[model samples]
Target: MKKLLILVFLTLPMIAFAQTKPYLSIADAERITAAAEAKAKAEGWNVVIAILDDGGHLISLKRMDGVQIGSIDVAQAKAKSAVYFKRSTKIFEDVMKGEGGSRIATLPNAVGVEGGLPIFKDGIIVGSIGISGVTSAQDGIIAEAGVKGY
Candidate 1:
């Protein structure tokens, strides 16, 4: 029993260290925002773009000319949901399309929208991006362009 306890204690630190997540640099955030904005413009979709670090803190935001004011908060919320949940908002939206779909709506901080995506580098999620002021599919496309910046 003493040996087992010692082994458990030794592994606890490893477990904690493994939980560490990467953060997005300011330059990277800027690149992502630019890419998202470019895609929105290329498609002629006026949109708001938001980027958030892995901890769900906003890093950068862009509001294209003519975008609705309400899209600013919605874009940030979608980015937060992506980073906080460590998955694309599309996944949550898909889950809501089938049986028991309503259960996903109960999850705290889960936006379940289609415009958010996690940004990954070296197979680790470093941040996320979200776009709004367009159709969900178009917003998702723009967000994907932003994620590719990393």
Candidate 2:
């Protein structure tokens, strides 16, 4: 029993690691960014795009020609929020503004806003993409454009 317990403890981390998959790669992030940039240019909608890894770290970002400089930070925050929270930023935005707004906002790394959309690969959410410099609806559209290839 003692030997079995020791073996189980030793292999638990490995087992947990195997359950999760790395669905988003650097190439995917770049490609998604490129697609988003192209769509923005074609539509004449300048914006800032931010892509985050599954762990909510920055993967890629693009500031378009005419986008306001402030959008970059907002874009990153939105992406981080989605990736870290594992849900849509829009949902958090609404929940945070509700009766328990303050309590909801206090969650670590939680961001309550729009413009963040999870990037799913093979039905698994591996990362998220965020777009700024336009209305939330437009941000959703831009992010969705990038997600199509995935």
Candidate 3:
């Protein structure tokens, strides 16, 4: 039992540090926002876009012309969900539609939508992007464009 406990303590930090995901730099966040905005403009879809670090901290946010004000909050919430959960908001959205989906609704700052995506580098999630204002599908497309930059 002593040896097993020692082994467990030794491995705990290794397991916790296994995720070597890098933090997003301000420049990187700016680039992501620009890419997303370009995509939205190209598609003529006015939208709000948000970028968040791995810890769910907002890095940048942009509200395009003609976008609804409410989209600002929604976009941030989506980004928060993606970064905190290390997955796309689409997953939560799909799960929420199932028999037990309502349980997820109780989670704080959980926005189950299709416009959030985790930004990965070298198979590690570094950050996330969220887009709103247009339809969920359109917002996802724009967010994908942003994630491609990071």
Which candidate tops TM-score? Answer: 1
Residue 136 CA displacement from its true place in model 2, Å: 1.7
Off by over 4 Å in 1: 1-21
- Candidate 1 lDDT at 149 equals 65
lDDT of 3 by residue, 1-150 (tens): 999999999999999988455678899999999999999989889999999887888889889988989999999988988988888898888999999899989998778889999898777777899999999889999999998866
Q: Write the per-residue lDDT of candidate 1 for residues 9-106, one digit (tens) a residue.
A: 99999998884556689999998888888888898899999988888888898899999999999999889899888899999999999899999999
Better of 1 and 2 by TM-score: 1
Candidate 3 wrong stretches, greater than 4 Å:
1-21
Clash totals, every prediction? 0, 0, 0
Q: For candidate 2, report its TM-score.
A: 0.77
lDDT of 1: 0.89
What's the lDDT for all of these models? 0.89, 0.84, 0.89
Q: What is the TM-score of each candidate against the true structure?
A: 0.83, 0.77, 0.82
**1-150 per-residue lDDT for model 2 (tens digits):** 999999999999999888466578889999999888777777889999999888888888899887898999999988988887778788887887788787767787676777888887777779999999988877877887887755
* Model 1 RMSD in angstroms: 6.9
